[model samples]
Target: MHPITTVHYLALSAALLLIGTVGVLTRRNIVIILMSIELILNAVNINLITFSRIWHNMDGQIFAIFVITDAVAEAAVGLGILIALFRNKETVLADEIDLLKW
Candidate 1:
């Protein structure tokens, strides 16, 4: 049996990021896209914490904390925007949004 290593953690993070990327690209719903973005951010946090553990340093963890804070703010703003858009447009489809189109 092989022992798990940092490589394993990194691979998992990569997979998560890939899934998130696909979701963001292929999903038409705005809320799902926002969730996918959060997933990508979580993958980043996983990598940061994993590297911090391997390096025996606090920097990665600190960065992860910052990332979490940013994610929270992003979620709040994203949901707020989503609500506003829904109220004005009555739909969540990305293609249906044209408020900024020229």
Candidate 2:
């Protein structure tokens, strides 16, 4: 078998991005949306690390670590908010949430 290349990594990243975008756009469940957002972030991390490896540079790796850190923070905060919303609304459907409405 042939060795993998940057193009292969890029293709995988693109597929993940497309799936995440579609999930965020089409899903009504808040949890699924959050997962999709995570997927998108992961795709970005893959791209960053892949390029970093190819160029033998540390910048992309450092940036990927930052992205991972941010993603963890985001997931924590998002799940907390989701828990609060579920407690108050008794529903996890995104369309049914109107907590911000005045």
Candidate 3:
């Protein structure tokens, strides 16, 4: 069997990102959208680690760590908003949470 290559990793990452983007765009549920966002971030992390391995450098790994940290923070804040919206509107659907409407 041929060994895995950077191209293989890149292809997987691209697929993941496409899935995540589609989910975010097509889903009506806020939670699903948030999960999709995380999926996108994870795809990015995979790319970072893949390049790090290919280049034999630590920078990509370090950048992946930062991306992970940002993902965590985003999840926390997003869930908090979701919870608050649920309490007020009792629905997780993005279209129904319209708090900005007059």
Candidate 4:
């Protein structure tokens, strides 16, 4: 064993990001897509924090903090949009929300 390291964290993060990307690309449910995006952001934070701990760099933590802020904002705005769409259409499915593609 090469001893668990920051690379392990990075690999996990990459796997999460890949899963999120696939979910976003393949899912028809709007809520699930949004959740996958959140997962991707969370994976990024994990990588940042892991690097910060491994390298003893404060900047990585700062970047992770900023990523958290962005994730929060994305959640707020995305959910707001989802709610508005749901109110208007009564469905949260991405396929049903399309207004321009006939």
- Among all windows of 10 consecutive residues in model 1, the one with the lowest summed lDDT is 93-102
Worst-scoring 10-residue span by lDDT in model 2: 93-102
What TM-score, over all chains together, does every model reach? 0.94, 0.93, 0.93, 0.90
Q: How would you encode candidate 2's per-residue C-alpha lDDT over 18-80 as one tens digit per residue?
A: 999999999999999999999999999999999999999999999999999999999999999
What is the TM-score of candidate 1? 0.94
Q: Candidate 4 clash total?
A: 0
What TM-score does structure 2 among the candidates reach?
0.93
Count: clashes, candidate 3: 0
Tens digit of per-residue lDDT, candidate 4, span 1-102: 599877788999999999999999999998899999988998999888998898898998999999999999998999999898889889988887668985
- TM match of model 3 to true structure: 0.93
Q: What lDDT does model 4 reach?
A: 0.91
Lowest lDDT 10-residue stretch of candidate 4: 93-102
> Which pairs, if any, clash in model 4?
none
User: What digit string (tens of lDDT, one per residue) describes model 1 on residues 1-102?
Assistant: 999999999999999999999999999999999999999999999999999999999999999999999999999999999899789889999988876866
What are the per-residue Cα lDDT tens digits for candidate 3 across 3-52? Answer: 98889999999999999999999999998999999999999999999999
